[model samples]
Target: MKLKSGLMGTIAALVMGLGAAQAEGVKVGMITTLSGGGAGLGVDTRDGFLLALKQAGDAGSTVDLVIEDDQQKPDIAVQIADKMIQSDKVDMLTGIVWSNLAMAVVPSATAQGKFYLSTNAAPSQLAGAGCNARYFSVSYQNDNLHEAAGAYAKGAGIGKVFIMAPNYPAGQDSLAGFKRFYDGALAGEVYTQLGQTDYAAEIAQIRASGAEAVFFFLPGGMGIAFMKQYAASGVGIPLIGPAFSLSQDILPAVGDSALGIKNTSSWSPDLHNAANKAFVAGFQAEYGRLPSLYAAQAYDTANLLLSAMAKSDVADADAFRAALAAADFASVRGKFRFGPNQHPVQDIYVREVVKVDGVLTNAIVGTAMTDRADAYADQCKM
Candidate 1:
């Protein structure tokens, strides 16, 4: 009888331990553009996130990461989100790379009481009136980098600037953001089709506008296309854009044509921080390539998740949300915190593309804004 009682007690203890472990473990569903035009960005983001997870040693033990490629399609993203939420029962939904896809996934995921941590694609609506408690953006608002560019352009004494972006939510945000801080006269504002390759017409317009400088927010293949064409166009006017346009992932494709171009971002590989130095070194060693801003943000997002998991069990939604709000992770950006809207409030820096040992990359040139928060944070009711 005594032996049987001891055996029963041991069995009960084992079952309870298993239950506790299950409660602590989290299931994450990441839907991002993995194929097509923006695949490089998504691939870098995934690789960075996975690198962080591997460093944490909790990827398979404490976290189950399920990644799906949206192919930059909003409808497909929505379908994947629905599947993740209803079928896979993911504790979190993240990694939508495009603003339109984020708009389709984030709100719905948050509405269902699931946490959505954005690594990129922080649309204005989500930062403002549509903000939700369950949603947090590890990346800057879509307009933040452009606003920094505007600030830099204004400070550089640029009198007339030509600005252009893709005709999308983020693109509109970019132009509006640039206009907000730029005191310079507008030479021209053009909205090209998203994923546009040939910029011959836009380049001609920029040349004819008598602009002192060109500011653009084209990302992925569009930016690569524009930079290559602009270089060949023989336009002597200086070109400035957000870091997305001149990211490390795309800089090699743009080659020396991107040299001397300045862009604004929150994170750079050259940032003088212990965390950043380690990340850059590790990323280079692991991937044999320089990490882009997208990769940095995604890496930060994964670390943020691991930090929150250490603080609270995934089954406890409120506790998990509180833990995430604490922002208790060592960020690659060094000084990092969350705004009232749960978006990042951090410094934005101006980085100039330069060739380092025959490889194209960005080097920090100046600080554009210190501890900047998004303009829409005040509009968030939460």
Candidate 2:
């Protein structure tokens, strides 16, 4: 009886040790813009990522997230990245909104042998010659939506257009992308100061530019302020932009001013796909609001990580990266795949802002570009 009892005790100890090993999860550091002007985008990213984990239940337990606020500052984001890597010992890093912040963090973090799964902010630089194998953008490249908008404008027979974006890497990419696909004449192209609230001066320029349409990419609070002021200014020239400025995050605040405005995006609330429908419904149920493109991207990033974790341990860098490259998860954006540069190669759609059931939201109006790949893919050696 003593011998049998001792054997059982040894078995029990082994079982407990196995359980502890299984419970060890991958540590992920999320540094995002959670305060100041761009708080909404970061909040949505965090909420959506958490929602996916919540929905996953036990399967999501494989990931442990250390989240921090970057306050929409490049230096702050870099500092948080360092702390996350050195102190928290994160296996991977994700969640940055602005292109400038991404530019500041992604290169160094990936260089340090930490994988970066970008939630947003896919700058052209990273997509091109500067591409790294350890970096993957779960979101569309910065140029994609602008390219879609440009295509939409050309299809709509708008001959002359005025383009404007914040004076940042993304802003530069936005206008450059619009020009890439836009065959129309440019009346004016203005680069506004990043986070500039008042658009009175730009509005005056637009009013005098005689452009048929205006394409702008002012994200977060900057967009909200611009739209409100533009609407009041009565710059009868129709305004168009990407989903960053026209999504559920900004539409409610912009009110009726955003009504009937055509914009480009890779995902919309009305996109009919099993994954997307579930994501939209789940996000609304979880957060009591519709998910924006930022939220959807972050949610997809989380699921991507979960899928990879299911296949291999994060400590095995090569195997984990291979798992991530496979992208064996249902994306909220439906058809998603990484291009050679590790940026998304997906369809872009045009969405119109419409009051849906007494709330402002976006609805898919048309498909702008299909199986669209960024122009910089060939430049990337990786």
Candidate 3:
């Protein structure tokens, strides 16, 4: 579905209205993991953000976006956040691909009174007691998709399941979220080292556990490595996971090994919405590749900021915050709204990896949950 001409006219009017004020343009700082293991995710996210800005027509006139590579290191992310705030004097900060980096950078930036709009990464702490008024996540909470996977497993009557994840905060959350809804016997649960490529040891355990299915949350190269090894191991158990493990950016690298795998996610390239159709077509035309959930969420983040900026000046923090909370923007995802914790409340779907015109990608199979809010929202006072 394309944006209606009326909506396009509205956006044009908003852009034209920006010229009425003599205020300084908004400055935004983005620190994302652009190198190392999961660089593809960050690259897609960056490209999506830029694509949205480009579509806005002369976005540089109203927004100054400064991007930095975190290199998948929390320390580097912290350093970049400091520079963006102290040197660049950015009014807002966004774009972090990993939960660990978000943990290190988001709180401090928000505490310092800078509005932090997270394109990705939804650490549990930020959605609960650590929630801040200045922070907003355009993506699902880290565990939401995992929880949907759990629900899917239950519905599919998978009575015995083995789960694995990288040993980190987000990893732990993945297991917890899965167990919360998966009312079945756990064959086993294991945590591998973060960024560990070899999974022979884990495969041995899975092979012997008599598991009916397997769920894992390894992203980037780790996922590619694990799937390749699993396929080679000839384990007949069906694989299930969150979208991160089999994202479009990583699916091509995984090849047919990832085909027929089922995963849960809040967005898909084929979502039957006007905004999504436009985004997917525009993304392919611009990058010569299909856009992943990471790219779609980042694209939505840019539109969110632009929508808020159209309604309220960034210099007016309270007004801007209120405007954003209103969520007066068209999301590529058909249904999107922010919960009390500033995280999305949307539908999560079960998707199967399939070839569309011989290109490996995900196809929506069924709805796992609808209008789901994060589990930790009640813990948030704001």
Candidate 4:
């Protein structure tokens, strides 16, 4: 009888160990701006996630990361998010680079009790009244980066600056953000059609307006087409914009035209940090190009999630959420933390576009915005 009882105890212990092992492997669902015109953003997001996983290096953790593409379409993003969450039964969901897409997926996914960690796309609604307890933004609010641009341009003594962006929801938010921080006279605010190809009328308007500087928030192909045409249009007004337009992707195509442009970006390949330097070098070596701000943001977001996972009891969703809320790790941007609304409170750097060794890149010229959060946080009742 004693022998039989001992054997039963051993078998029970083995079963418990197996259960614990299965629970330890983390599962993540990542969806991003893939396919269509903005697929580059997805490539960067996926690469960053994988690179971060490699860096964790035997933190005694395993991850099953399921990735999908949004194709830059709201309907596709919704379908992908629903499928990943339902079919994969993922522990967490992350990485939506577009605000419109995020707006679609967050409510549905968060309602299902899945923790939604947004690596990009900071819709204003999420930060304010529409905030969700299960939804956390790993990146800053949409306005935060644009406000940085405005702050930098204002400090540069840029007077009568012309601003332009696609007349989409996020684009309007970007313009409003810049205008908030820029206490300068407006040359004009031009709302071009979302994907307008021609900048001839805009260029003529800018020339006539005589703005000393130009600020814009055009991402993806919109930015590429605008910059190429802006340069071809002979509009040379000390152009400034967010890092998306001045990104490595668009910069290479624009060539020397990107030079002498001043801008503010959420992330840069040239941040003076060991991790950032390594990330820049390694990503460039592998991909044969410098990492864009999108890449940097996604990379940092992955590390932040990993850091939280490393410190938390993964099986305990509340504990994991708490760890992420605290934000204990140093990001590629040096230091960052979460506001009460779960948006990043981090520094924004003022960078200048220049050709270095025949490569178009931005140099961290100075610090413009530091440890900044969105102005909408005050409205967040969460």
Q: What are the Cα lDDT values of the candidates?
A: 0.91, 0.91, 0.90, 0.80
Listed in order, each prediction's TM-score against the native is 0.94, 0.94, 0.93, 0.91
lDDT digits (tens) for residues 203-305 of candidate 4: 8888888899888887877788888888788767878888877877678777787887878876777778888887888777777878887777777877877
Estimate, for each residue in 303-323, the C-alpha lDDT of model 2 and write its tens digit: 999998888877678988999
TM-score of 2: 0.94
RMSD to truth, every model: 4.7, 5.2, 6.4, 5.3
What's the C-alpha lDDT at position 140 in model 2?
82
Locate the minimum summed-lDDT window of 10 residues in model 4. Answer: 18-27
* Reference-based TM-score, model 1: 0.94
Which regions of candidate 2 are displaced past 4 Å?
A: 1-24
Where in model 4 is the C-alpha error above 4 Å? 1-14, 17-23, 59-61
Alpha-carbon shift of residue 49 in model 3 (angstroms): 0.7
Model 1 spans > 4 angstroms off? 1-14, 17-23
TM-score of 4: 0.91
Colliding pairs, model 2:
none
Candidate order by decreasing TM-score: 1, 2, 3, 4
